[model samples]
Target: MNIHIFQHAPLENDTGAINHWINKGNHKKFYTRLYADDPFPSIDSFDFLIILGGPMGTYEEDKYVWLIKEKEFIRQAVNAGKKILGICLGSQLLADVLGAKVYKNNKKEIGWFPVTLTPDGRDHALFAGIENSINVLHWHSDTFTLPEKSIRLLESEACVNQAFLYETHVLGLQFHFEATPDSVISMLESDSESLSISSDSVQNSEEMLNNLHYSGKSNEILFTLLDRFLAL
Candidate 1:
């Protein structure tokens, strides 16, 4: 399969597990670095599209002009029947593109937090082998209302809409299941100032670094999800 990625920041990109999955499948990979004003690929060029996380919010189009174009591109991809997976800000963008309201949550969730699968998620094939609840990295202040016609997949105490699936082909996850130890460190360093905020949802750098082992389980879940999603 030909895969394409839409990356929003310099430090935010695909994890090692995702890269390994692509290599193992011998898939062709492409990218559009939105931060650098990279060009987007034609919709028909890639079989699957992966959108990575970033610190920016989906509503910041005035500051990031590229966001306007990117949303339109995502809308186009969805209309074209492409399989797409979105993480963090990417998920918020997907929600906005699908005519949902995106706004700040009451609290910022920025740590390894437990996200429980909703009843729909429990029966969904995408999360077949995964546990009912798992700790995944959450680093977003904004959340979105579920898109019309999308199934709510996951939820957490901090956020209600943790994950959603739109028409089977498009999936949006509010947390990070593809984060590696190195990627976690990079994200922490990139937005270290946010750590100083006093909130139960936010974890200190040391605390987050100590729980790097969680990524192993998260990565396994991610692999299973991707395999099932692609096979659909």
Candidate 2:
């Protein structure tokens, strides 16, 4: 498969389960580094598109010019029926492009948190290997409403809409199932200001680091989802 990745930040690239899948076969992988002004590829060039998380909000197009172009790229990909996976800010982008409202949640969710699959999600093949509820990594202040005609998949204590599925081809996740230890550290370092804020919803850098084992189980779920997605 010809897969293309849209990486919004220097530190927030896909790793762990995603890298494992990418290295599994002869499949080609490509990337567009939006932070460094890397050129975007045509929608037809890739069979699968994976958009990574970033610190920026979806509405900050004025500050990040590429967001406008990226949205258009996502729109074109959806129109073309590309298989798409979005994480965190990437998920918010997908929601907004699909005409859903994206905004700040009542509280930010950082570190490890539990996410429960909705009935639709539990029954869906995309989550076949995942448990009904599991702790996954979280690091977002914003949440999105379910897109029109989309199935609400996951929910958390701090965020109601942790995930959504738009048709069979598109999946959006607010939490990071693809994050590695290095990537988590990168986030803590890059967004240290946000981490400094004290709240019940937030976890300290040490706490986030201590729970690396959660990703082991999360990566298993990720691989299950990816296997199903690739088969589609």
Among all candidates shown, the one with the greatest lDDT? 1
lDDT of 1 at 224: 89
lDDT tens digits, residue span 115-177, model 1: 999999999988887799998888899999999999999999999999999997999999988
Against the true structure, candidate 2 has what lDDT? Answer: 0.88
The lDDT of model 1 is 0.91
Tens-digit lDDT string for candidate 2 (1-232):
8989999987677555788878886679999999999999987799999998888999998999999999999999998989999999989999999999999998989999899999988888778766799899999999988999899989998998999988888889999988767777777878877778889889998899999888888887887788887776
Candidate lDDT values, in order = 0.91, 0.88
Q: Candidate 2: misplaced stretches above 4 Å? A: none
Number of backbone clashes in candidate 1: 0
TM-score of 1: 0.97
**C-alpha RMSD of each candidate structure in angstroms:** 1.0, 1.3
